[model samples]
Target: MTINNVSLSHHGGEEASGLLEELCDAYADAYGVEPGEEKTVAFRRRAEKQFSRPGFALVTARDGGRLVGFTFGYTLPAGDTHWWGGVQPEPTADFLQETGSRTWVLSEIEVRRAWQGRGTGRALHDAVLGARGEERATLATGPDAAAQPVYESWGWRRVGRIPGDEGDYYSAYDLFVLELPVSW
Candidate 1:
């Protein structure tokens, strides 16, 4: 079950703008990211870009008004060559193609430390994922992230490793993909 008083809800782009700070703040809490850290800043920037994309959406878990968790992503446009942020060994040309509605990228899913193991993250995940209308979905996860096991159990498969950017804050991550309408 989820933590007491937590409500899961949806937010579109307009509403999402007002929630960026709160969303990033909750992200910092969940990821142990220091204030003003490069990753934190980069996350905000990427989030802003995500907001501008068509079909951007956010799902949040709030404990009676306090942000406890969030997950967001958007459907990729017809051409998003940079979206992968660069994958190692590269993928086949066909695999790199996008039809604007073929893929949904789950950018980030975070649950604050205090809310861990109470089902908040899973509920948020299921809610947002259940809302997607794409043929497939993808996300990046660190080898040691707490959510990795859950993703694996839910049928997400490794695609390839996305190398970290120049900044050290962004470590290399394993890119994962799942076919749409996951049962779990």
Candidate 2:
């Protein structure tokens, strides 16, 4: 199924709730585990709060009225943004403190399982790159062979790795970076 008819739009707080759930569920499912009720509720709450912020933006894809995916990110204090923002169990102060300059951190990218290879992810990623020109782009994903190819294909270079606490949350993740030339 080619995603030739998909539409992309920036999502607001109220408009983002329902669709954000699908994205979060995609995250959990992609991790190969079922999310607990608490986890699901917390994910929505956090996403709502972030989406409420001024600098944060979400790009969503819809096909015939059903949402297939979305990507969201925010401008951090350069020294205060992590690849996943605050999604991980670890506090982001350390991650934020290590930074270069003028860049927006990609908080999340989610595409429905069925729509995985249809360019939904790239469409959303392009939105971010277009919105924030120049400044390096960054994100983290599983280190398994499956995710590496996608990151490389997207032009994201492996920069560093984020260590996580035990509990089966981030056992195979690695951080990747993309140096986007600032087009004046």
Candidate 3:
């Protein structure tokens, strides 16, 4: 599918909440998982929580009025033990300090299966990250995910891995971080 006609838009949390179903559909299609399954259910709940975060942001791409892709994240709370607790190889003290600012946690980026390689995902990812005011951004991806190379190419570096949680969506994932421009 050609993404030449795709349009991108940034949405605030309230607006993004309304797009949850469409976002879940895109995620399900991309991952070959059925909606309402264990992982999908968990994801839906997480997305809802993420949308309510203080610095929540979402960027979406639509092709001819249909949602094709989206990416969303929120600023990480400083000193939030819940997030840092997952780091496999503990990071340095500076990295662990949150101050309720510092890092933007990219929770999810998904494109419909039919739109995988047409740049929809990139457009959405870049749109979301480009709008963040945080000093850096972080995301976790399955160790062998197809997007790993894309993240690396975009200047993200692997920091460590987080062990899988019981009944979680991912078994284990490598954490990646990228420093963002002070001004964008």
Model 1 collision count? 0
Span of ten consecutive residues with least summed lDDT in model 3: 77-86
Scored by CA lDDT, what does every candidate get?
Answer: 0.83, 0.65, 0.84
Candidate 2: lDDT of 57?
70
Q: Count the backbone clashes (under 3 Å) in each candidate.
A: 0, 3, 4
Clashing pairs in 3: 78-98, 78-99, 78-100, 79-98
Model 1 Cα displacement at 166 (Å)? 2.1
Position 138, candidate 1: lDDT: 91
Clashing pairs in 1: none
lDDT of 3 by residue, 1-184 (tens): 2447998988999998899899888888878899877777878999998888979998888888998888999988756656666787888888878877788999899888898888787777777887777888899898899889999887889999988788765788899999985232
Instruction: Return the clash pairs for model 2, or none.
Output: 79-96, 80-96, 134-182
Q: Which candidate gets the maximum TM-score versus the true structure? A: 3
| Poorest lDDT segment (10 consecutive residues) of candidate 2 | 80-89
Q: Rank the candidates by TM-score, best first.
A: 3, 1, 2
- Candidate 3 Cα errors over 4 Å, as ranges: 1-3, 182-184
The Cα error of candidate 1 at residue 167, in Å, is: 2.5
